[model samples]
Target: MKASLETLEQHFATVIAANELSHAYLFVGATNSGKMTLAQWIAQRLFCTNVKDGQPCGECAECRRIEEGNNPDYLVIQRATRTIGVDEIRGLKQELSKSGLEGRQRVFVIQDADKMTPAAANSLLKFLEEPASQVVIILTTTRLARILPTIQSRLQIVTLQSPTLATREQAIQQLGVDSTFSHVLSTTQFSLEDIQGWLEQVDAVQLQQTFWRWLTQILARKDSAFTLVQTQILSTFKEQKLQQLLPDLLLAALSDLFTVKFALNRPLNWTNQQENLQQFANQFSTQQVTALLEIVLGLRSMQEANVSFQNVLEYTTLRLLVVLA
Candidate 1:
């Protein structure tokens, strides 16, 4: 089940009711921040024949078709490869030129739109300038700063923050995570997918062992031998699933180190590995912790750049070792 995007959903429904909706929208936010979910809800609201208050009547034939991916007027543009090229944008323009097959409105959603090539972005800009009467284009991007300036100026920008702690906790329960395990995985913010994923991947006993082993290797090794450990853990699971947990693992590790360094009295979750955490804390200053975060983020960016996961992992491990030393 998807987490609700209640506020943005209401706003979009209001705009549709007012008939003052902009021709284009740029959804700017971090990964898994509800941008795509909001876009779909907006699309359903725009096409729903009977709206009850602010939500679509999921019983309607139109809403059903849209959910089933059978709606003729609704199109979702995702990268067929690493980037959206000029031909894809050109094809969309051709599709838009035709009359709307559906009576109400035609919606096109471009997922990861920041991956649009320069020529494709220019093509999209032309469409935004003289948009079709009943057509709406929605662009979703994690890297809003990288979006074309001309394209940015033409569209209404919606910034979605990470979900609150309470919302994330609710999601953890909704995802059927064991109640006993909630406190450990409950801190993720504004991210439904990550919580859901953790709930799936985690086994309290196994997780404790793996986390301790990983932390131990990082602290004990001098020449970054833990690169092999990183590979082994990541390989034992699905790549996407493992990647989803990286941020949480890193954040937890960092927070523990930070607490010890600052002499804060926060309770330690890593009591079993307290010695290593404290050792790392004493070895690296705040700047080094910040740099390690950048290295982790840099690895993700490289994956976005279409670099192989092996290459990214190798480079990241080497950088992390050097920084730690």
Candidate 2:
């Protein structure tokens, strides 16, 4: 069953209240799915001197210090790049060796724990095996498969679920996205964190519209789809951003097309372009749409493997054109 963030928080609070806290916790979920936020919340409760009814008083000095990153008892380890190295883990180990200077409990949160190098992960494993008393270790990762099995076996794993539709809609609205784009985003499997990241991009709406128009043209077998890739898409966005967002936009559009073809009353990513999507959907067989959707979904893994963004876009355009032909 799916649990909301509040439910998970309350469960953790109860665990803390009972003094049944685990030595280590592994939070696994999609990026921006509140893993880090929950980690911080737990940290606040752990450090708070004014805990009441299984919850931390947010106005407490301990809570404020943790929030401001000024708490010596609370340490956060994160890398700016792809991998967290041995030196970083070693530094954390050294810090963990010490006792909490200010707060009653020491809490260490490692963000993107799957990005740790093998040696770094092993170092962490050693530390977890001999964890300090009164210290709480929280590790978070979007890519759970990449974490070492030995380390995974040592911690309590918390898998966060995507929020319910109502919660997601409220979040999207608060992000200042208009009803149209908000409806499109809230319908997808995207988490609140994912929506927030998209909104941070200045060209997010343009990118979505561009991908929609390109898909429509490709289904119509128009040469402008290929032209748009070369002149507009490739030139408009950086390679990294293009590689990330393009596949997602395409997949969402494909889902909308599938829904439109089947006359499903589901929400769509391109809500304002429903008529256009219906027209596009009518031109393709269900099997054809399904096949194209698979192709687009496969692009995500390719992008993860450092495949060329420009080549992927060109190849996708060519493949879709062939499929339509």
- Clashing residue pairs in candidate 2, if any? none
On the 0 to 100 scale, the lDDT of residue 313 in model 2 is: 81
Q: Count the backbone clashes (under 3 Å) in each candidate.
A: 2, 0
Best prediction by lDDT: 2
For model 2, residues 1-325, the per-residue Cα lDDT tens digits are 4365789999998898888999899998765568878988998888788988878898998889888999888888876565799999989998898888864778899988987989999988988998888899999887788899999999988988755666677778898877776766665545565557656765566766666677778888987788888777776556353356567667878888889988888777767878988887888898888888888888877766667887788778888888878
- Report the poorest 10 consecutive residues by lDDT, candidate 1: 181-190
- In model 1, the Cα lDDT at residue 111 comes to 90
User: Measured by C-alpha RMSD in angstroms, how accurate is candidate 2?
Assistant: 3.3
Count of backbone collisions in candidate 2? 0
**Residue 136 lDDT in candidate 2:** 90
- Please write out the lDDT profile of model 1 over residues 1-325, one tens digit for every residue: 2234676787777887888899899998766678887887887887888889878887799888888878989899876366899999999999887777856679999998988999999988888999888898999987788799999999999888756655555666677655433544666332556555555665545654565566556555445445555555555434464554555555566666777777788865344456767777787778887777676665556777777656655576677778777
